[model samples]
Target: MSRQSIVTAGVLDAALVLLFAAIGRLSHGETLAGLGVTAWPFLGGLIIGWLLLRAWRHPLSVVWTGLGIWIATVAGGLLLRLAGGQGVQLSFAIVTTIVLGIFLLGWRAIAALVRRTSRKRMPAPV
Candidate 1:
């Protein structure tokens, strides 16, 4: 619920979307100049995801925020792309889901693991 956590979650999720686009562009030998085209649709979905799920409350929670964003992004992005006459192949959907799942949820999973480890190492409270 803190301001910093909300900001961090937003930044992390947005950066993952950008990273997904940038890395895909690199893999396809496309220039980064086209990142806007690649990133905007997903970013749009990210906005919707946040709004629909009230993700700001727990934006880094894997089950709620992360999964919600992934599903919303894929569905929203496909709709946007379809409206724009852009390609929305099945393969793209599958790839987007897998990659976004990793990027969005992966960090939180790692953080949770680390927190668990740290807690185990701490002495019992007096």
Candidate 2:
């Protein structure tokens, strides 16, 4: 992939992580301060998103990408729980993964739609 595409993917991943954190905090009736300290969750989301993008043949395949990300995030969380001394909050991790997947995949879907529309609008060579 081109450097620009890589940068865009990173931006999308970061946005998804932020969105997941925001939603999690709101749902739990917690403050942003609490989220700030728990950076692992968001980092996990970022890693999952990046992996999904890397695994997919095309960035436009949002559904598959999202599914991949969801699977990876949950599995990663579980592994982390098993490997780490502390217990992992399964529910919280699952919810965060789902939210992050949706945001990242949703952006990809929108980008695909925009590209398709633009292609259709372009003038053909005479």
Candidate 3:
């Protein structure tokens, strides 16, 4: 993959985490003052996953990087929230896992499909 694509993958992952945090905060009627706090757990988890995977080199790998980010984000987010005295509801956990999986994995899946289709459409060189 090109350097630009790798960077874009990382940015997309971060953006999705931020989006998830923002939506959750809004849903809970949280004031904007606490937005940073609300976003940090998941973000922290994402960072850890990136580090563990050394993801900067290959951020677009759906199996390694994407799955690692998803698992780390959810597990780390839950653990951190619990440590911070934020109760984790079964329903909330379920929603977070489902939504993050969709957001984190969805883009990569779409990109892969597009690349596959485009490759098929290209004519072979003589």
Candidate 3: stretches off by over 4 Å: none
CA-RMSD of model 3? 1.5
lDDT tens digits by residue: candidate 1, 52-117: 999988876888777888889878877877887789888888898889888878987886788789
Which regions of candidate 1 fall more than 4 Å away from where they truly are?
A: none
**Local accuracy of candidate 3 as per-residue lDDT tens digits, 24-85:** 88888986678778778888888888888888876776787788888998998888888888
Q: By summed lDDT, which 10 consecutive residues of candidate 1 come out lowest?
A: 58-67
Best by TM-score: 1
Question: What TM-score would every model get versus the actual structure?
Answer: 0.92, 0.68, 0.89
| Candidate 1 TM-score, true structure as reference | 0.92
Provide the lowest-lDDT 10-residue window in model 3.
Answer: 57-66
lDDT of 1: 0.86
What clash pairs does model 2 have? none
Residue lDDT tens for model 2, 14-59: 6666666666667778887766434454456448655756843444
User: In candidate 1, residue 54 scores what lDDT?
Assistant: 93
